[model samples]
Each structure stands twice: as structure tokens, then as C-alpha cells.
Target: MVRIAIDAMGGDLGPRATVRGTVEALAANAELQVRLYGPREALESEFSRLPKRLGADAERLDIVHASSVIAQDMKPSSALRARRDSSLSMMLDEVASGQAAAGVSAGNTGALMALSRRALGTVAGIPRPAISTAVPTQQGGRCYMLDMGANIDASAQRLVEFALMGEVMARRVDGLARPRIALLNVGVEATKGTASVRHADALLKEMANINYVGFVEGDGLFSGTADVVVCDGFVGNIVLKASEGLARMLIERVQATFAAHWGSRVVSLLARPALLRLRRQLDPVRYNGASLLGLSGIVVKSHGRADALGFACAIARAVQEVRIDLPRHLEHELGQRAATAPVALDRRGSGVSPCAKTDDFNS
Candidate 1:
């Protein structure tokens, strides 16, 4: 069984929603073992009420007491440094100690990233860790988008590395072998966007590691043009928020329209199945969280406003990631690429450059 350490004190709803979610996830997947980390008395009190509210499977749950709790408004680094006994810190400690396969939190993202880097470290040769999110496409497929908010500013080389990592994750986690990758740009043309996008485009086109399907505009994100989309965190965050906002708006509009009158109520009854299907497709809860990749240990971050179902889904995702040995697979792939790729040269002519010697060698 894959063990997941959860930050029971992090989210807005506190232990109630988180504990409820834990119960729900346990019920859904019997093989999952959750170690709830938070204030001892609070968690125990909540657990006591779960048997009557959620059921007797509460026995399967484990609790690790954390005296201190980090607030959402607190600075991530300060919170982590000052409150060493916070729930998030304790959860990460479990992951680092190998007591838990992964850590799941609906806590402050900045704190999570800082704590993760400090605790687990990053994969070799990776400049910054990235947050990879799975976005549902119109073709009933899911496209993986990376650098969601990990690194707001990135270089062309960083984007290229993110693409490679994203491709590996898409295949390993989503079971998509040879997933098509596209560089997210303003236009579909290779010449589109600023210098960063252009440089990334050139590098992607030349890289033989993954399937580089050229450029894709923002509009094509939901159209399923590519299985993996790469971009800097700034742009990726915008795309993520836009998609979320649109989904929420559509759902709200449908709900308001259906409540207008008797005629619409009849129409709503007939369309309930279709609406539910649509909700499930775009539901943030279903894909409730994203993984912070390139870190040595797994860290899954969920929405701050996520309810019990969303938290449950995040737990499930963490289990899947651990079961698949995500970090080990990434390390192997990245190490292999680093080994095969030519080493970087200094400004002085210490050795023959691969770019310059290629034609001469072929001749």
C-alpha cells in the first residue's frame, strides 16, 4: 500500500473537510494508507465524529500530531523557518524520512515549494522545480501543462527541460506513450512570440529526446492539439486561471438559467445527465491537484477552496504517483539524457564544439 502524508490543518475548511475527504478516499481505494498530520487534539476530535458522520473505517486512518499550524497569509519561508512544527513541515519531514511515499497539502503553495526544495531537494541538472497540471481537452483526452506557478520567469533552456519532464510525466502518469508535445506560444508559427519562445522553439525542434509537434496557440489548449504543452509559469498560470474561470462561469450560468421558470426546469431535467457529464469533465475536483515535479520526493498541491471530494481526488493522485515511482523514473530519464548530450564548453576553445564539428565529421 502507498502511504500518503496529508496536511490536515492547511485548507480553509480545516480538519473537517480534509478528514472527510480522507474517509471518502479510503472508501474508494482500500489500498491507500493516509497519515494525517496536524494538531493532535483537533484531529482526534474530528476522527471521533467521523464514525457517525462518514463511518467506522476511521480506524484505518492514522494521525501525526503537529502543535503549530501555518496560516495562509504568512510568508512561506518565514512560516517554514519560524514554525518548524507546522503541519506542512511535519508532512514533508515524513516524506524525507521515507515514512510516507508522498505528501499532499492544500496549504500555501509558496510554503510548500520552499519547504519541498529545502527538505527533498531537486533532481540533478534541473534549475527549478515545476508544477505540472492535467487539463481536460475537448477530445476527451487530458493534456499536461507544466510550470504552472513554480518558476514565473524561465529561460529557453528551462522550457526545453520542462517539456522533456512533462513528456515523461504524461507517459508515466497518464499512460500516454509518445505523447505529442507543443510549445505554447502566441501564434502557431515557429517565428511567433518573444525571444524566449523563439529560442525555445529552435531548441525543441532540434531536440531528439521527445516528440516536438511544433507550436500551439492558446486557443488550441482545449482542442487537444497536443498531449503536453510547455511554457513559462507566468503564461501557464494565466491559462490555468482562465480555463478555471470559464468553467465556473459556464456552470453558474447554466444553474441560473435552469432556475428561471417551469419550462427551463423541464429542460434542466432532460439536460441533467449532459450537464453532469460536462461538470465531471471540467471539474477541478476530479483533477483537483498538481504535482511539483523535479523534486526528490512527491508533493501534491490542491486548491485552497477544495471540498472533501477534491481533497479525496488529490489523495488518489498522490497514491498513483507513488505507485508509479515517478521520481525514480524522472531521475533515470534525466540522467540518461544528460549522459548522451554533449557537455557544455567554456568561452575559450577547450574542446571541439558539437555544432561546429558535426558537418566536418560527416564529411
Candidate 2:
């Protein structure tokens, strides 16, 4: 059985959402075993309300007591120093110790990132992990976007790293053999973006291993123009948040319009199936898991506010990663590239050129 460690006390909803989500995942996947970490009493109380189906599935769950919980607004450094016994940290410890195949947390993103790196370490040559998730496109396809709030200021070399990692995600998760990579910039022109982006673009163009497709503007993200889009955490976070907010808004507006009058309500009934399909497709909760890529082990970050269903989706992502042994594939790819064409670096042995530090984007 594939065992997954969960941070039951990490999210805004605490054990209520996480325990239920764990039960849901257990019910869905018969081969799954969960090593849930949190206050044993609270977790048991939450599990006390489960139906027979979940109760049966709970047989595979093993609750390990964790005294501390990581707060949503907790600083990463403080969480590391003071909350070592936190559910998040304990869950990662299980993964690091080979007690679990992967780890899942609906906790403080910063804390999860920091603790995960500390516990699991990083793939060889990866300075840090990148937050990545698949975002749907207008053509009914999905694109992998990365650096989604991990590093606020990614240097040119970091952007290249995001590209390589994102490319691997697309290939492994989405089964794209030659995932096209792009740099998100103000314009598609070679001269329009900040120095970091331009430098990364030039470097990517020279790498035959990557299918680097020059540049794409924000609009290109949903246009199905690229398979993997790389950007700094600042920009990636904005894009992801904006897209999710817009999708939620659009879905609500459609529902409101349909419920406005009796005639529309009748039409809505006729279109119920289509609307449900659309909602399923557009709901941000459906794609609630963001992978902390470039780590030695698989770690999935669930949205802090995710409900049981959403958190289950995060668990599902972890299960998928485990089934495929994602990190090994990434290590293989990185090794191949390092042997052939290593990333370009300046005299300082960094991805940035002298002008990159002054670039408005990185700054």
C-alpha cells in the first residue's frame, strides 16, 4: 500500500476538514494508507462522525499525535524554530524517514515550503523548490505554471530552473513528450521584458533539451500557446490568484443569471448537466493541489481554505506523484541535462548577469 502522511492540524479548518478529507481519500483509494499527524484527541473527535463507509476506510488510518500546529500567518522561520512538533513538520518527518511515500499539507505555504526543504532536502543542483500547479486553458487543455509564491525574486537562472522543472511536470503528469516552455513577460517581443526574462529567454533558446518557445504575454496563458510557463514567484502568484478569482466570479455570475427569473430557471434546469460540467471544469477547488517541485520527495500543498473535497484532491495529487515516483524522474532529467548542457552562469557563478540584479521584474 502507498502510505501518505498528512498535516491534520495545518489548515484554517484544522482537523475538521483534514480528517474528513483523509477519510474521503481512504474511501476512494483502497490501496492507500494514511499516517495522519495532529492532536490525537481532536483528530479522533473529527473522525467520530464518519459514516460506515469512512469508518471502514479509517481502519487504514493511523493518527500520530502532534502537539503544535502551524498558523496560517506564522512566519516560516518562527514555525521552524518554535513549532518543530507541528503537524506540518511531523508529517514531513514521516516522509523523510520512509514511513510514508509522500506528504500532504493544507497549511501555511511558507512554513510547508521551509519545513519540506529542511526535511526532504532538494534534488541535486536545485537551489530551492518551486510551487507549481496545472491551470486549465481555453482549448480544454492544461498548462503547468511555476514559482507560484516560493521565491519572491527569482534570478534569471532561477527562471530557467522553473522552466526545466515545469517541463518535467508537464511531461510526467500530463504525458507531454516535448512540453513547450515559455517565459511570461509584458510582451512577446524579445526586447520588451526585464533583463532577467530576456537573459533567461536567450539561455533557454540555446538549450536544445528544452522546447523553449520564445515569449508569451499574460493573455497567452489561457490561449493554449505554451505547455509550461515560467515566472518569478511574485508574478506567478498574481496570475494564479487572478485567474482563480476570475473563474469563481464568472461561475457565480452565470449561476446568478440563471436563477434570476422563472423562465431562466427552466432553461437552467435544461442546461443543468452542462452547467455542472462547466462548474466542475472551472472550480478552483478541483485543482486545489500545488506541488512543491524540485524536492527529493513528493510534497503537495493544499489550499488553506479547501474543504474536505478540495483537500481530498490534494491527497489525490500526492497519490499520483507517488505512483509515478516523480522525484526520480526529475533527477534523471536534471542529470541528463547537466551532463550535456548545463545552465549558463556569470562570473559570480549565478544565473544572473550584472544587469539582472537591476531588473525591475526581479527587484
Q: Given candidate 1, what's the lDDT at residue 50? A: 69
* lDDT for 8 (candidate 2): 90
TM-score each candidate.
0.89, 0.91
- Candidate 2 residues lying further than 4 Å off, grouped into runs, are 53-55, 343-363
Question: CA lDDT, every prediction?
Answer: 0.78, 0.81
Tens digit per residue, CA lDDT, model 2, 155-206: 8888887898888888888788899999999999889899999989989888
Candidate 2 lowest-lDDT run of ten: 354-363
* Winning candidate number (lDDT): 2
| lDDT per residue as tens, model 1, 20-52 | 888889899878788899988998898787655
Regions of candidate 1 where Cα sits further than 4 Å from its true position: 51-56, 342-363
